[model samples]
Target: MKALISNKVFRIVAFADLLQQSAIWIRNISLLFYVMEQTNGDPVAVSLLNVLEYTPIFLFSFIGGAFADRWNPKRTMITGDLLSAISIGVILLFVLAGSWQAVFAATVVSAIVSQFSQPSSAVMFKRHVPGELLAPAISISQGIMSLFIIVGPVVGTLIYSTLGLVYSLAAMIGLFLAAVLVQLTLPPSPRPPERRAVPILEDVKAGFRYIRGKRNLIVIAITFACIGLGSGLIQPLDIFIVTERLQLHKESVQWFHALSGAGMLVGGAAAAFLGQKLNPRVVIFVGIAFLSCSIIVEALSVWVYLTAAMRFSVGVMTAFMQIVLGAIMMKLVEEAYIGRVNGAITPLLMAGTLAGTAMAGPLMKTFTLVPVYGMSATIILIAAFASLSMKLGGNAANTERSAVHLD
Candidate 1:
């Protein structure tokens, strides 16, 4: 652990990533508040905002991955920050100019720019960290990221509701700017780009070919995709339980979210500590299993405190699964094609997110939070079953992994 956190370059890089992940929450919570304000707190509008934020995965992630492979991760990360900052800046100005749609479009563009950096950023951790420490380190990073997401919305909303939207967004822009500056001081990471490139169709084909041929990768990828669909329901769950199910006071909702943040902080720390001693695959299954059960517990409509407990549990589960899968992916791929691997899998995962969010909005509107939680539970169980059948029995992994993206 000392070695993991001690290196100067790794520390700087990880801090920058922490800031980067924070920006996601800052932007998301800000947008959620902005759209809710504009639409009179319509959940559909909020869900649409969620869609806008993720639309890039459907549109540009694979290309982003390929670009990461073609360029230095540091430069690419800086570029992502610059583009997102510009988009956010313009949107803030647009909001000042009385155009909410322009602000929405700007957020969408920011999402697009961020997607490009993700593949590069995903690959960079491996470049900087030693092999043995990757799992725990990634757990820490994911935990920190989840912590920000938990805070960003609650904080962003308080500030926006009090200080107004412009000031809140201004704060976000400053953070992104700071992240870019931090990224600049990192060590140079250069990978060889193909001097002669394949056609776009062929490049995409190659990525898909890799996904199709690798059963474990497919199992993991599809599992997340399914989980994403269920988890995506979260966009509306906050509002739904706050208003419809629990009929809780607004302050209670805020407090629940705060509790979730606290849970994420603790859960992430626990995963980081326990991860090194555990099988990455089993740790992932445990997290998912726990997460599914949490969601199912949520569906029972017991009470607000109970629901909060479930979400807290979900926070822990989400952090564990996220950290474990990331570690597994890093182990599974070649150093050369990590970018491509990220690019390929992201869209499928995004599709799940899209499907989940979209599905949740309609379900919550028509059915209730119970069904939404049920769906979340069902998807996770499926992932667990898939893990079992793939011969991992929820714990199968080759300690000696190769880039098995071939037939």
Candidate 2:
């Protein structure tokens, strides 16, 4: 781990990633509050904001992956950062002009650009990080993400409360510019080989065929989709749990999220330590099993502290599942196809999340929170069982490269 962090490229990319992610979270949280204020707390408008935030991942991830596969990773990432800065600048302009609707437009543009940027970042990791060090590297990355998840909202809220909308947008622009500067320091990634001219649709189709040939990849994608569904089901209900079931104030909900973030940090570190010693498949299975159990336990608990504890446990287990799955993919997929494979699976996971979120309200209205929680647990447990069939080996000796044909 020490050696991995000491590597120059890793350090540069990590720093850039931290700035980029912080900017994104700050923008998202600040915008959410801005929209809430402007719309007078209209639930439908707020929900629409959430939908706008995530919809691009569903619609553009595949295309982004295809482009990432074809483009230089470093250039792709730099362009993304630059465009993000410009987009935020546009938002700042809209805010100054008192055109609130244009702020939403800027949000959509940034979200779309992120789909391209994210896969490119994945490509960079695949290209630069040694296979043995990938898990620790990813763990470090996830830790940064988890830390920001806890801090970003607080920072965004603080800025919004203290400085107001224009200043908040200016802060995000500055962060993005910092990211761009750091990204410029990254070493250039090797370009993919030029092939005979082929239609973009054929390129995407070939990526799908590659995954189709790998049973392990299929299993991982499906398991992740289930996890997304389970997460979506439980997320919206947390507010209800705090407000209705546990009889706590809505503001107290931040405690649950904070604890969960702490758990993610601890869990990521543990997974990084265990990466070389344990089979990723076993790690994923155990994480899912525990996460599912935690959800069920949280549902049954009446006390707020117990539920919070369960939320923390869920966070820890989720970090393990995410890191191990990512490590497995990095190990199996070739550098050329990493982008497309990730692009292909993203929508499956996002669709599950959207579907779960869409279903949670109706299910709660009809069957109540306990049943809805139970249903989510059952879905996650099913994913746990499905993970058992994965054939990921315990060590490098049994690992096999994915049979993906890029041509």
Candidate 3:
């Protein structure tokens, strides 16, 4: 942990992530509030915002990843941030012109830019951070994210309420610019030495083959898919849980989210402490299983406190499991392919989330919240079982790599 703290690259990247996440939250919350004001709290307009935020991942992640692999990591990341800033500027102009609908463009452009920048960040970790310290680095990263999960809404609301949408957008622009400057301090990243001079479409095809041929990667893909599906099912229904199940106002859902974020903050610390000492398969299996159980309990519980406890536990386990998985991916994938692997894996999760989210409304309409939540829990448990099937001979470094014909 000490070593991770002292690592210059890690410090720079973590700070940059901090800036970017702050910007994202400001944009997310302020825009949501702005849209609600403009549309008089229309649910469809709000839902459209969610779709804009997520659909970019499904549409652009793979291509952005391939580009990340093709470009220098530092350069790719900087370009992404710069483009995001520019797009936000454009959106600000349109807003000033009274084109309120252009606010959706802010969500779309940033989300698309993230699909590129995010994978490059992983490649930076793989290249710059030492293998032994990777877990702690990721733990710190997730911890920062969890912290935002707790505080972001409040911050965004404060800014929007006080300064209105214009200044809120300005704040986002400033944050992105700050992130770009921090990232510029990073040591120049050299492109991977094993680069193939193939067309991107061919490289993407190679990425698919790479995942297909590796047993562990295959299992990881399945696990991601399941997590996405299960998460998607319940994400849209949390409000319903508060209103119908717990007999509380819909606004009370914030407490559950806050509790979950608090749990993640603590869980990140614990996962960092455990590090490689915890067996990957067992830890993940337990994490997902616990998450499944928590959902089931949340579904069945009429008591508000019990439901909040489950929500907190879900956050803790999510942070723990995700940090471990991230470290494993960094160690397991070759630096050359990290971007592509990430790009490939992220879309699957996003696709599943979208699928589940789409299904959640209809499913709830049919059977109500409890049974729908139960089905989501059942799907997550299946993911836990899937994790057990991963065959890790030892460490991620020792995992077998798949031979691909990039030619």
lDDT of each: 0.73, 0.84, 0.88
Local accuracy of candidate 2 as per-residue lDDT tens digits, 282-348: 7788999998888888888888778888888878888877888888887778777888899998688
| Total clashes for model 2 | 0
Off by over 4 Å in 2: 394-406
What does candidate 3 score on TM?
0.97
Best candidate according to lDDT:
3
Compared with the true structure, what per-residue lDDT tens digits does model 3 show for residues 1-407?
78888888999999999999899999989999899999999999998998898888888898888888778889888889899899999999999999999999999999899988999888888888999888988998999999999999999999999999999999988999999898889997765676548888888887887777677788889999998999999998888889888899878888889999999998899989996798888889999999888888888889988888888888888999999988877777777678888999868887888899989999999998888999999998999999998877555335465454343
- RMSD of candidate 2 to the truth, in angstroms, is 1.7
Give one clash count per candidate, in the order shown.
Answer: 3, 0, 0
Residue 284 deviation, candidate 2, in Å? 0.8
CA RMSD for every model?
Answer: 3.4, 1.7, 1.5
For model 1, residues 1-407, the per-residue Cα lDDT tens digits are: 78887866667767887777666666677777777878899977876776687776678888777667667888888988887777788888888898877767866787788667877776778788887788777777776776776666766667667877787778778878999999888888755544566665566667667766657778878787877776777655766667767786666776776777777777778777886677766766777778778776766665877887777777776776677777777876766667777888867766876677677767877886777778778887777766543334233345224335431
* Backbone clashes in model 1, listed as residue pairs: 229-356, 392-395, 392-396
Candidates sorted by lDDT, best first: 3, 2, 1
